[model samples]
Target: MNEQLTPRQLMILVAYFIIGTTILVVPSALAAEAKQSAWILQLAGTGSGLMLIALYVQVFKRNANSNLFQINERLFGRWIGKGISLTIALLVFVFCAQVLYYIGRFVTTQIMPDTPSEAIHVLFIITVVVGMRMGIPSIARTAEIYFPWVLLLFIFFILFIMPDIRVNQLLPAGEFESMSLVRGALQVMSYSFLPMFVTFASLNAAYDWRSSMAKAFVYGTLLSGVMLTVLVMVSTMVLGPDNTTTQLYPTYVVARKINVGNFLQRVEVIVAFLWFILIFIKLILYFDVVIMGIAETFRITKHAKTLTVPVGLLIAIFSAVVYPDYVYQQEWDNTTWVAVALLIGLAYPIALLFLSLFRKRKAAAK
Candidate 1:
């Protein structure tokens, strides 16, 4: 028996997943490539992402009572629908692992330089597993409680770091290249919101499927885009593009620069604290989706208890082995892999929309 989530719970899950660790990494990375135009890329990416969301909305609107798994079964027939469901489940598993890996690596390298990546990974996994075992309602409740603190901390961090920002450093005033911005935005769209398709699909099974999903998506995108744009602009102003490109954690570096008189020095600790909370929320949401997905596919009754340890172990092992080093990972992300992601994330939904339409028309003619 699958449990249904309320609309408020669904909204929190969407918001938390959308705002995860990517918030920490993306601004610096996009700024490195797009520079002052990074915000433009983010805006363009959000627009492109919304188009994909529309396709998803169309599918859900057509079959408002069914989840993606059920929709797949209807659209593709029994065997193929099962295959599609498994494929989506596997993708969510891999995504969850990769997110955990990235968070562990970030913690080890940036905040606690002395801590082993394995130790960090284990601790992170433990926290996520505990949350997943508690069920979706618990996770949603946790977010509601912590969300205000997360927002407050983010505001404080941004304000405290503003004093260190050098406005002149933000510009030699380069020409705006529209094409480059579009390309960069396309890249972001591939990685960021596309993953949310799976989550949205999963949640649709349990929530009231309608325009509300689209509303949540738009709100989440706008919130994430604004934060990312501010982070990029601030990092550019403080570190300059050339230097920002070379740095590992440009936002962290910017946070380290905060110095308010003699009293408020060493505020990077606070930044790390806030980021840890966000990352934990992200990990838990992904873990929840993966567990729920596996249970739904296999027709299991008690999902929360059954799959927790196995998935955690799988993520731990895979995260350690996913990349030889950060450079290789970055290269893979920037090159052909992201293009493949765009196809899966963006193109796949559009294909489904067309197929659904053709099916409807043929049935109507008959």
Candidate 2:
């Protein structure tokens, strides 16, 4: 059971988790709101994310012996704790489905406009199920091996896109409104960073010591934050505020702009490859969490391999029907989705932390 995610492994896990679909879609989402200053909002969002990780680490320290489910049970009584655990399990399930939906959408719009979405969905699910059956150690090790390559390509893409950057495009400083920038940052924080709470389920891989937990969460969040900011920079500088806001995949557009010579045309292939790696890792992690949550819910400590298919099938079907089309998906993510994530992702863990601390104080006073 001790996959024992090293600092290196945790950092990559978190970087993948944060960057996933957001890098593809968020520039448009943020630009639609904050315009030229979206990169500045991204910077602020990263700081907000760092604070949230600090909060999560504190909860982990207080409930050192418990996984997320056990922590819920300890914080509330049996029935209520089970209820909360079930709710979280459902959230994790929906989470995987949403990520799946993004994969389908990306493939259809960005890569192969003619390919059927369901075909992509089925193929992706097959890979995810196999990864889940193999389990976290395999997943973590695979990430360890492949993450560096993705990172290198990402760095290459950023450097590749630089010559096209128009310094004047980011000027004017949101001349119309400043509040939009604040909202933009909040959206970015919720969409990208706060979801890291999902890591609570597999946190047993973290070393038992409090500092180890801190190292894993802090380093991971910081690294992912840097990646997000770099992506925003590239998107805004190259595409300009108006075009960045209107495009479906601003970063991909930036990649498409890369052309050193006629020989190097269409190297946006690197973006596609980078995204496929990152999104696949994100989907697999959430898929694994759903299985883990079920085991914790029913106390099925033994063989939950039986649970994988039902969950995977459920997610695949749900993903297909989740959002009718790209426009609605984009709207929901910017407006409703962040609110939903905040209520569950932020609400549950912080409440659990408060209750645990209160109970600890009562015990000491007695």
Candidate 3:
């Protein structure tokens, strides 16, 4: 693995990873709680996300050249750190399965209703496994390649849907309950930001974590945050809060409204394509970090690729039962996921940083 990712590539990966499943699910999720003020929740979430990225940058600064697994070992000693690393790896593995389930479900319900979700899971997992086998350089490069197309499609989606936006849809904005806004913001952070803990593992692939790289990280978050905010806001204004809340993928539905002269109609596939790019990048990155974390935890550097197929198979199996039903999924996303994301993405890093400072002080005294 003599691979290195440029800052530009890192930026693209971060942006795509943040935008991944968020583009589809967020509008409805936010609308459910915040209603017309859903976009405000997104703004707050994104702001907090930038703050988290700053914290991550500090963590990376303290533990330069080491991935999250190695950082755990360095901060907590060998066995305990390995235990922690393995746990995090397993959590990410579960996330991979969840993402796989998301894509499979999306396709079955939205695109190909006749196709079995299991088939979609298997097919998508194969691509992820293949991408992982190619290593991070390839994955980063692929993201860079797809970045422009994603940006263009998103811009076009916003532009074409402008005509359908109803200002009155957002007329009663800022009228939500305080708890509802808090919950909505937390949900947005849980889905769009907190899972970025995986990026700590990816930092090892970067050429350098210099200031430029740090800026790239923030830039990625900002770009994705703006895109998500706009998407959420537009969904509410165009589809109304009621429609956005009721639909599973309000953004996808919004795409159906892109009718420029009727000739440019029925381009909902563009939304799907954009999501596939973002989701695939995110899925592969998750899979990559899972493999890396496990290998580093066990010192299996030479044969990490060997674990790919077995891992892929397990993810596929897990996808089959990740959710008992969509109702359960919604419950899990709103409630369970926030706690889980906070644990892994927020609390875990803070713990490591505190330990790092404690060790530094002890060493200084010695």
TM-scores for all predictions:
0.91, 0.94, 0.97
Give the alpha carbon lDDT tens digit for every residue of 100-144 in model 2: 888888889888999988889888998888887887778878998
Worst 10 residues of 1 by lDDT: 1-10
Deviating ranges (above 4 Å) for candidate 2: 174-176
The lDDT values for all models are 0.72, 0.78, 0.86
RMSD of each: 2.4, 1.8, 1.3
Q: Estimate candidate 3's alpha-carbon lDDT, on a 0 to 1 scale.
A: 0.86
After TM-score superposition, what is the CA distance of residue 84 in candidate 1 from its true location, in Å? 1.7
Sort all candidates by lDDT, best to worst: 3, 2, 1
Kindly indicate the candidate among 1 and 2 with the higher TM-score. Answer: 2
Candidate 3 pairs with clashing backbones: none
Could you tell me which 10 consecutive residues in candidate 2 have the lowest summed lDDT? 202-211
Return whichever of 2 and 3 wins on lDDT: 3
lDDT of 1 at 110: 79
